[model samples]
Target: MKNNIGNQSDYDERQIAARGQAFQLAYFALLGALLLYACSEGLFGRWCDAGAAAGLCACPSVTVFAVTCIWRDAYRRPNERPAGMIALMGFLAVVNLALGIVRICEGDVVQEGILTFFICNTAVGVMAAVILAAYLLRLLVLRKEREEE
Candidate 1:
């Protein structure tokens, strides 16, 4: 196949297996979180709107998946350089965080004591920031290990 980036485009068996495990773990985490959210919402009226609640319930699972994949060394293909992906993630974090801050400043994050859908922007921004931090930390640790070896 013709390649624009690199010859290696697909993940190896180890990465695939790790990713499958990560997916399973993430799925279960999401289900568990949603269950807890449902129970809480049922018990104590609506604290947040549906969209904010969804974002709250979903961020942890996404974080779990990203962290698992990154720590397992399965986040990037063998020949992939993560620079572009990292830049994109950084951009997403900045934009979402800025927008979230703007909304909060404008007093749009909460309405009548209930969180609005605007909370999703901050949730997503935090998730992206967390994932990016994990990726960079792992990269640093790997580099240190290489230097030691």
Candidate 2:
């Protein structure tokens, strides 16, 4: 009887964790694909190969690990906040924006198969930045209200 009563809360926590994992995987897939596209032999220059490889393989792997760790930390330690996850998202947005600009400056972004996908990356970056900005604004407003109170 006691176990059954507590099962609902446990079930809900499992659901939230499951959703977070799914979101993490989806984010990885999207960023991985874009990095692969950018690294395509004929699309970008030789200088970009190392950077692209780092982004495609190393970066995503590290990011996923970091996020999973943060999530687990929160799960295991209730008082711990999700500030790391928020920082990760903002960092990713900045990385995307930087990659987009690097591609554009390379002079090959508008050429051949790179044009459409490069634009897509830029657009995604812009969207991410907008979301980050919204989060920042909300945080600032809430802080101000707390101070006023």
Candidate 3:
């Protein structure tokens, strides 16, 4: 893509790279937000209410990351793998949401139990796995496209 201003011609490689970097940075930020919410509410509060609240906070990050990826890639390329990764992430987010609801409904007594603690920890594990898998999928797809070019 080329931009012209009077007699000057400019290449927009930096702009495209900046957009890609911004999208990746946003993804990283969303991941950090998810971790912070989990730690602050789930671990610190020791109540189902905390988990519910944290889950509410996390939902937006998932949505934002998915939409940002879609928008960033819209004009450039047609990559089905990123869409698949987003779909998987969306599925995992729904599972996490359901687990959060279950935790919230179980009351404070359940939250205090070792089994409940382990279950919540397991939910976190699932989230971590989803995040890692999505990141890897995105990296692999982008690398393959670059190689093709």
Candidate 4:
């Protein structure tokens, strides 16, 4: 039988290089965020629950990776259209934000002077929104460049 795995060689050299750099940067960002989280917790005390802490550590690296890929024009496959992805990100942002707001209104986002797991919904929403915004901004800049050229 033929190999069932993907070709894995579809990405061109530039895309591969860009992705490598993005991964490196994202890794550094994740390390820094985790270090900060640990230091903050050790110094000031627990400011957020585990879920929120995880979001705090994860969001920055994800954003860095996505933004880097977007700027490098490597966020999508060469044949892919971004409209569907844009719509999906928008939907995720809206849903998470709505849920987060509901949780806040219900007084479920914080307890005993520390943020609870419910706050992670807001963090996830914010991260998605930020990535969406970056992607849109990159698209706009590319459009402008194309128009000028």
Which residue ranges in model 3 land beyond 4 Å of their true spot?
A: 1-19, 23-65, 74-83, 108-149
Candidate order by decreasing TM-score:
1, 4, 2, 3
Any runs in candidate 1 off by more than 4 Å, and if so which? 1-7
lDDT of 1: 0.92
TM-score, candidate number 4: 0.89
* Better by TM-score, candidate 3 or 2: 2
Say which candidate scores most in TM-score. 1
State the lDDT of candidate 2 residue by residue for 1-149, as single tens digits.
36543343243565457557746775776677666756664575543344434444444444444344333432223333437646866886888788888878885456653343454455556655655565555557656888999
Root-mean-square deviation (CA) per prediction? 3.3, 9.4, 11.2, 4.1
Candidate 3 on 52-138: residue-level lDDT in tens? 445444544554454454345432233234456656666766776566566656653254432243244335535645564646566
Q: In candidate 4, what are the lDDT values of residues 30-125, reduced to their tens digit?
A: 999999999999999988888888887998999899889999988877667889889988998999999999999999998888988888788789
* C-alpha local distance difference test of each model: 0.92, 0.54, 0.53, 0.89
- What is the full ranking by lDDT, best candidate first? 1, 4, 2, 3
- Cα lDDT tens digits, model 1, 53-116, are 8898899999999999999999999979989879978998999999999999999999998999
Write down the TM-score for model 2. Answer: 0.42
Instruction: Summing lDDT over every window of 10 consecutive residues in candidate 1, give the lowest-scoring window.
Output: 1-10
